[model samples]
Target chain A: MEYFFELLLSGLTRGSIYALIALGYTMVYGIIQLINFAHGEVYMIGAFTALIVASILTMLGWNEIAILFIASVVAVVYSMAYGYTLEKVAYKPLRHAPRLSALISAIGMSLFLQNYVLLAQTSDFMPFPSLIPDLEILEPIAHLITTPEIAIILTTAIVMVLLTFMIKFTRVGKAMRATSQDREMAMLVGVDVNRVISITFIVGSATAALGGVLIASHVGQINFYIGFIAGIKAFVAAVLGGIGSMPGAVLGSLVLGCAEAFFTGFVSSDYEDVFAFIILVVILIFRPAGILGRSDISKV
Target chain B: MLELKNIKTFYGNIQALKDVSIEISEGEIITLIGANGAGKSTTLMSICGIVPPRSGEILFMGKPIQDMAPNNIVSLGICQVPEGRRIFPFLTVAENLDMGAFLRKDKDEIKRDIEYIYELFPILAERRNQAGGTLSGGEQQMLAISRALMAKPRLLLMDEPSLGLAPLIVKQIFEIIKKINTENKTTIFLVEQNANMALKVAHRGYVMETGRVSMSDTAANLLANDEVRKAYLGI
Candidate 1:
């Protein structure tokens, strides 16, 4: 029972990070039908920015909580700029081109960003600063959970709730939904599709930055190549949840996280990555549209 | 009022509209009747700035608007009810209506306009919360027109609103169109394949063949012309 609880706690923590990253993939796909392959690099950039900010703030004699707050804010802002620029420079011009061409452009962008970061920052992994204070108030359950794990879960929950409300109740959200349903029709109805697409990238990239900060603090490490593997896993999660469905992305992330945790806990840890892909293949074979995805029927 | 002077549009290498000149006066129902591939729909698309005329000018209220974007054209009070009633399938009827008034900031007026749309199409009011895709074909067409009307457009472009509908439903839709024109005093440009029904309701008629306006006359004159009677009226 104790082992099961430990696995569950760890699974939820990891799943929160995956869920945040997967949302960027899902939303960009929803509006433009493009799988933003470079999103993981945005996450990596977030972590590096946070790390640099923390190191500078610490040297300047800021307190721990203040450093965490300031570092996260700066990282998130920088990631937002990166995301907006990525879309405008890399994706926007190719929008009217063939789907295959756009896809190739995205992969090229992913490679370019990864190499750019490698050249700018060190190729070696750097230690992430642990700024979250250890709480002694949960001593009884501390064996199963940590303070950082609690923080990650709480932040994910709050962000998810806020995102749901915004997508459901706001005007821009309605425009997004409309555009996703039918782009040409949405335009005829007075929607500025370019603005909507840009906003989607901004929001998605900001959330990815948050995920990057949380995961870096939790794992106590950062590297340029980390985004590649993490991004592939989050892509699997998005595919598992129904690529364009927001709630489906979160649910898929949780399922993927829990499956990975249990596999590592009970089965051979050596083949953990293999297990995630195997699950994706099996689920796709059974339901090609994904768990929560509605099958699109083109009208004549 | 709107005017298209010597407008030409193409689909890649093939021309869809060639030297198409048209003029519409305010508070009049102008109908363009033609067979399939006669450039009737292309005329509407050019006016709405979806496909800019390769040459000539499109003047809405005497100002050239050939370079404006589609969304900007809507804000200028020209709205289109596109063919096949392209309502957002997943959105509820009420939500779809709300999207129609997307560019408006007058909150109270938007609310009142919505109420007016409901009164015009009571079936839409009853199915307000239902998903748009689940509605019947006739109902979807009604929602499409109502959605466009929600924009409070001075000029409404309708593309075959009566297509694929029953005779009774077509009559009902035509009655609603006439009511909207007479009551709201809106200028209308209608494209239709059903010549008999279209001519009965229009103040003036233009007969398009291939990619140009082959004939233009008052509705009564076109209804009496020998060629029109034989070719369109099945006399």
Candidate 2:
């Protein structure tokens, strides 16, 4: 029973991180109907940004908590810039082109950003300092969960609550809902569709950056290739819940995370990824539209 | 209120409107009647700056607006109720009305306009919280028109409001269109396949064939013209 609780806690931490990354995937897909394959590259860039900022702050003898917050803020700003430019250069011109063309451009972009980072920084793994402070109060259950894991779960919950509030009550959120359903009509009603698209990219990139920074601190090292694997996993989560549904993405991530954690703890760790894919395939065969995804009911 | 001089619009290399000259005075209800693929919607879209004319001038209230963005055109008090009554399906009826007033700044005025809309279409008020997709076709049409009215436009452009509705519903909508024009004195640019219903309300009309305006006259004269009656009115 103790072992079971430990595995569940770890799975929750992992699920939270996946939720952060999966949101970007789901939102971009929701608004533009593009998979945004370079999303992983954005996460990689965020991690790299945080590392560089933290190193500078540490050299300046800043407090550890201060370094964490400042580094995260800088990383978010940089990732937003990258996301904005990525949409303009890679996707904007192809807005009217075939979906395949935009998709290919995304692939090319993912490769380009990876290589750019590889050349600028080394391809070798870099050690990352733990940014989340150890909470003395939770020391009673220290065996079951770590401070970094607690930090991740708490942060994800806050982010989700804020995101849900924004989507449900804000004016921009209303425009986003309208634009997603019928873009031309949105234009007719005076929505600046291009601006909405930019905002979506910015918001999505911010969440991915938060995920990147948090995971780097938890894992103790990053080679950036981590983004590709983590990104693929999150994409799987988004698909599991329903590609375009926000709540679906988080639910899917939690389920996937728990499934992997249990399989690794009880069975062999080597088959963790294999087991995840098998679950996805089995679920898809039965529910192609995903757990919460409404099958397309396009009206003529 | 608006003028299109020698306007030529193209979708890629294929022309949709060619040399489409038109003049609309303030407070007049003008309509363009044509068959499918005859460039009627394209003309409205071009005027609204969704598709800007390639090489010509579109002057709204004597200001050159040929190169403005869609939102900018909308800010100039030109709002469109596009073809198919393309309401956002996921949005509730009330939210759809709010979206129509997206560019407006006056909160009090917006609220008042919404109330007016509710009064104008009591059925829409009843379905205010319902998702637009769940509404029947006639109900959606009412919501679409009300959504446009929320913008408080001096000129309203309606595309095929009568396209797919029962005759009784169509009559109700046409009556509302007439009421809107007279009550607000808004200049209207109506595009429709239902020529008979349109001409009865329009002060003047243009007949578009292929991509050109083949004829232009008073609405009553066009209704009586043998050529228009046979080809369009089915008289």
Lowest-sum lDDT 10-residue window in model 2 chain B: B82-91
True contacts kept of 1: 0.69
Residue B55 alpha-carbon offset, candidate 1, angstroms: 2.1
lDDT minimum window of 10 residues, candidate 2 chain A: A291-300
Per residue, candidate 2 scores C-alpha lDDT tens digits across B77-156 of: 99999988888888899999999999999999999999999888899889999999999999999999999999999999
lDDT tens string, model 1, A172-266?
99999999998888888899989999999999999999999999998999989988888889999999999999999999999999999999999
**DockQ of every candidate structure:** 0.77, 0.81
Off by over 4 Å in 2: none
lDDT of 2 at B210: 94
The alpha-carbon deviation from the true structure for residue A203 of candidate 2, after best TM-score superposition, in angstroms, is 0.6
